[model samples]
Target: AQTVTQSQPEMSVQEAETVTLSCTYDTSESDYYLFWYKQPPSRQMILVIRQEAYKQQNATENRFSVNFQKAAKSFSLKISDSQLGDAAMYFCAYKTILAGGGADGLTFGKGTHLIIQP
Candidate 1:
């Protein structure tokens, strides 16, 4: 089993600025994937970014990027140029890669409420 932890329960950032959300995980499996998901008021879980444990390079998507430290088991999300649309509940999640290219159910953190101040 895997577990993810978000130290911050909530974070605030000014519009057009940058904010980094911290996350850490514990797992005994060697093959797995880390992810950052954003859930808006609509209750839709949006994929923000993902990092494979086998990959050394951090994952990035537009203004969203991750600082992945495999050894330290840290995967944090950096939201650059934060916008009102970015305001949501950000969750850190992970799932172990199973044989036959299958994956287990995602394990998510408590989540951090991101507030984009205008």
Candidate 2:
């Protein structure tokens, strides 16, 4: 089975500094999607951003973005102008892109602990 890997267990950024979280995955399937989800102290898995396997352009959402290297199977998240609210546990997730994909369970990494410097 394909699996997501988060090499960095923890990361800290200044209130206005930018931080990048590392994420890597191994999958044989060609059609799939990669996602970055944030789990705050409340434990809600908020979808921060995502990328499609076929898209050449990286996915971005407001201050969040992804550096997706399809050939290397790497999908890292970059947060710009970090803030206290950005402190949380971030997870790397993967899922197939087709019918019944939802039926198959989603794969997630252990998650990276993000800290914000006041």
* Leading candidate by TM-score: 1
Local accuracy by lDDT, each model: 0.94, 0.92
Cα lDDT for residue 75, model 1?
95
What candidate 1 gets wrong by more than 4 Å, as runs, is: 101-103
| Model 1 agreement with the true structure over 13-85: per-residue lDDT tens digits | 9999999999999999888999999999878898999999999888999999999998899999999999999
> What ranges in model 2 sit over 4 Å off?
100-102
Q: Which ten residues in a row have the lowest lDDT in candidate 1?
A: 95-104
lDDT of each residue in 45-72, candidate 2, tens digit only: 8999879899989999999999999999
| Model 1 Cα shift for residue 78 (angstroms) | 0.1
Count of steric clashes across candidates, in order: 0, 0
What lDDT would candidate 1 get against the real structure?
A: 0.94
Alpha carbon deviation, residue 108, candidate 1 (Å): 0.3
